[model samples]
Target: MSIIGKCIGATVMAIAGASMAAGDPTGATASPQALALLGGLATAVSGNLAHEAYNKLGDKFGPLIFARYPEIDRNHHIIIALRLSHLDAVEAILRRFNESRSSDHDRERQEEAERVSELIKTYLREAKRFQGDTKGGRALEEREVLAALPKAFETALADRSGATPDVQAARHETEAQVLAELNRQIGSDLPPLFIRVFSGSESGQDGWYDLFVRAAASRLKDDEAFKSIWSAEQLSRIVHMLSLTAGKIDRVLDGQVIAAQDAERRHDEQIALQRRILETLSTEKGVPASELSPILERLLGHVDVPIADVPTVLANAVDGLLAKSKTLVAIHNDYPEIDRAINEARNKLKTLDIEGALTTIRSAQERQKELQKEQLRAEARLHFEEADILRPLYDHQGVIDALRRGIELDPEKYWQWCALGDEYVAIGERREALNTFNTALQVAQKFSGEREISVCYDRIGDMRQAGGDTAGALEAHQAGLEIARTLAERDPSNVDWQRDLSISHNKIGDIRKAGGDTAGALEAYQASLDIRKTLAER
Candidate 1:
């Protein structure tokens, strides 16, 4: 025997020997009677008979051999079967192997199963086409069919996923038409091999259809008889068509499986939604149970609510509960007061004096306003008095806080705003002082006279000059000067207004001189001198 053959034989013998030794009834060796029977059988078997006997022995222990060593390929099994001359046994074993590998849960196995199914269909169609045409017409017919198969498979697999029922039905109908055409071409000449392999009438349990197609295609490639009749190109075309058909089948089957899974998922979601609704209703105590009865009835209606629509329904119900809760809380908290008001209004309506009732309501509203004003004034007085006490202790911030409260209570009080701005300036908070003074000026213009407004402008200009903003100081001083001039023009005999104008002109001159405007500064000073002269004469 060849070196490889001898090695395989040795391996098999070693496995069998190990099995026998492990199962030995006696601790030492085989029984005397069993040894005598083995000696006789060995003596009778020789050469080819000995090899055949070994093959039989291996087959009897096939499962044990595989269990002991799983890496053994189909080639090894074929060698054993050929040696024993049990080809049918090899076929049965392979059939079982293929069936064992088939699974709906395994994607790769499902894809492979689909591939073999399409290959069988392709082989049947090609065989029919070849038989229908004469020898001279064979090549042309083969080319036409080969060219069409790829495009047909491509179109079928393109939108296989999420296909509507009508689309799926149309595809199946197309496949049926193609099969019927093939049947017509072959007529009564349909080969028994083709019929047996392609027929779908058999029960699908054994998974023999896929096994037979794989075996037939493999055999045809190696068969000398087939090679003589079909060109290399024609055989290649058959192989190509089988490949395309397999891919198409896998795509279609995958889409169908995914679609079924989606349907099941939606059903599960609906069940979960129903359970959630029950749980929510059981725990809910805020909203009246009677108000939610319609929602519950719709949920349990004969026509089921889709899972997608359940969230919106639940949200609306929650919003209704929230609104109702607010109403309930209001009624619970203010029930006594609301009840009294309503009773009073009802008594007035019963007296049939509508105008008197309206007048009474207005009078009550006016009194309420007066009381609110008195409360505000009391609060303001308390804060202002506290500030006066805190001010003697040098609590300038406390003074500002008190003044802010007084101003907030009565913003029309210009004198209080002037006091607040003066407080801000005393603390060296120039920015705050400037803003307060501007606000006070606005209020004074509207409520007080030019005296208060001019004082605010004069303070603002002093703050700007101290903060080194000469241009800003000039602007503020010029504004104060204009206001002082207006006041003095209105009452020339008023010494305070005349002095205010003179002070404003002097400040403007100082700012201009500080800004390096010699001529402008001189003119401003001359104007200040003229104002001071006028004030002195008065």
Candidate 2:
């Protein structure tokens, strides 16, 4: 029934209400707290009150709370909460709190004496003896009769100092109880003020690379440690890794937002995320905000700026995260459960089968890497040096659909387009396959002379072969072989290029033999054999 608690509980009730309206939850409303926790998980944020006091606290605790209540994420109700933060509405909250008081102290509700002002104004028309203002946690702990007295109170019919015994005694007891609660709150409920902010540009490590290596290089000049360790290549790798993680988070978020396949389960993942963050924040040992690095402050505070003059509003966020991130990282390193969850979820995506070990992103990268290797072996098994492999987890059409989505998100990811071309082949849509391959070709051409582009030509040949155009297929194969040969010539010492040329030659020989050109086939085969044998020696 507390206002700040309403921020957490109300949000949960709202979700439960929504779930009830949508359909019956097997266990919803069975335990309101359980359901409420689900709502928190769906939101995956820290306590609103904590966030109002410290930005990092929200980031750290939101996840922690959800983790404590795994059921919340599975049945979470807020799809947009992830994009919003407690700080987003802190101003309104402050204003609302200030407005609620009648001619009293500051809006923050500090001090038991000030709470008396509101009590006299609201609970009694005129408490002639009332003075000062007070409210909140510290106010409620009072055991005195005066603690019960509201801002408003009835005026004494006569001066209490001159009243009869009965009247004097009544006022005395009332004042005693009223003062008790107020005095209690003064010592209890009040928390230090701070602010919490959220940012998704990328994780902290990625932010470090971008700000230092790309956006503003000047900042790096002062840090000899960073400068000594910096390199364009290393920075690029960092950026790339950050980008991949960001994408993974985004993709999982997208899938969860859509509530795809047991949508409730997505809530569970978020709950886990929140719980982990909290456990991290609560346990970490943090330095003073002013003493920390500027970037570190920005990341921990979830904002960007100098820390010397922390705004009352921003201070809450800055303080919380400073203490939170360390706790989150420390506890999480010992438990790779999140990793297991994500991998399982991605496996579900890969197979379109969300069964055991699916519906979670337990080891997606590992699975993807494994798939990439599988695809590599499949292509290597083929005679074409640059064979493109497209293995869609869903149906051929579904593969196309997923590819379309992937392309829309990142046109630079040509490999997915090449993957989509597989569906065209499966459905006997050679023309579509050819056109898709051509699109892949265009994307690859952007990175000209790359082995990927050479593979595109192999795709073209596959399209020709599928279309029963042996002559065109043969021509495509020969052209690909020529490109591979030229690339090998340009890098005589490069074994990969040499291998590529060999593969192409083997394919050309296969095509010639299929065409009854035995003599030509023997020559090409022998030459390929000789080249491969020589490369093996070197």
Per-candidate TM-score against the hidden true structure: 0.34, 0.27
lDDT score of model 2? 0.45
Kindly report the root-mean-square deviation of model 2 from the true structure over all alpha carbons. 31.9
Model 1 Cα lDDT, one tens digit per residue, 1-538 = 6533433333333222222222321123434333222221111111123234334443333343334345553223322212121122223433443454453344455565555445544544454333322124543343233221111222332343544234344434433443444445444233332333333322333222223223322332232322233335533433343344344444545676799899999979866766666566545634444444445555455356665566556556556544433332123453454444434544453333334444545555556677789889878887778777887898899999988988788787677777787888889888898888888889998998878888888888888898998888888889888998998889988888877877887887788888998888788778778877887776
Cα deviation at 477, candidate 2, in Å, is 1.8
Q: What do the candidate models score in CA lDDT, each in turn?
A: 0.51, 0.45
Q: How many backbone clashes can be found in candidate 1? A: 0
Best by lDDT: 1
Candidate 1 weakest ten by summed lDDT:
38-47
